[model samples]
Target: MKRTLSLILLTIALGACSTQKPANDPALVGTWKGLRTQTDKCQFLSWTTHLKPDGRFTITFFRDVQQTQAIQTEQGTWSAVNGKNELRTDGVRMPDVYTYQLVDADTVRYVSVAAGPSGDCQEDYAFTERRLR
Candidate 1:
């Protein structure tokens, strides 16, 4: 009886260690599009972001709200940290943190907390993005 109990405990411990943790913010693992207006100028910037389940992301930026002209594209990785989202792009030194919340079933809001190397126009910026269906 003593040997059987020890074996059972060991098996249970090993099984627990082998279990995988859930992915970070699984609901944000899709394509999202939004338009952010510049605070100091009459500029409307349109962006489309694709967040993968593998913690990778790609964002394409356009100058107009209609997204007819492509400006640039950036690749990065993102993760959820302390109820906020942290995005780290390639060639950037620091990560950009944002407060993310769900606006509706298909829409989400992201407010910038800290600016990074992504060429943000100003501070105190917020944008609403809809998940591409």
Candidate 2:
């Protein structure tokens, strides 16, 4: 009886360890905005990203640092993969991967992995996003 119980417990533990969490992170389901300072050519820019629980994401870009002028908006799907955030835009050929860390319950900082510009800019950027809702 003791051996049987130990074997069953081991199997259960192994099964638990094998299960993985869902790809989408619930904490990211909200509106977030950030600003970036660029070169003279690009100037100040702002990005507003809205992530939904259903894996849908929308990003709006502004030409100014204060997010006053809307420039473009892109729709995409987002997921958490291998401890990183992956965003697949609708019309883009490649997905954008970002390494992120939650600063607090209402803030997250992300750094784009050499995947090129995440917006209309010419290079990758690291920025912080604050939850709007």
In the range 1-133, model 1's lDDT, one tens digit per residue, is 9999999999999999888544678778899999987665547789999989899999999998888899999998898744589889988998888899987768988888888865666477778899998
- lDDT of all predictions, in order shown? 0.85, 0.82
lDDT of 2 at 57: 94
Please name the candidate that would achieve the greatest lDDT relative to the true structure: 1
lDDT of 1 at 102: 84
Query: lDDT by residue for model 2 over 1-133, one digit each (tens)?
Result: 9999999999999999889557687777899988887776567878899998889999998988777889999898898755499888997768888889888989998888746245445356678999996
lDDT of 2 at 49: 95
Q: Once superposed on the true structure, which residue ranges of model 2 sit more than 4 Å away at CA?
A: 1-21, 40-42, 116-124
For TM-score, the strongest prediction is 1
Give the TM-scores of the predictions, in the order they appear.
0.78, 0.73
Predict model 2's lDDT versus the native: 0.82
Candidate 1 global lDDT:
0.85
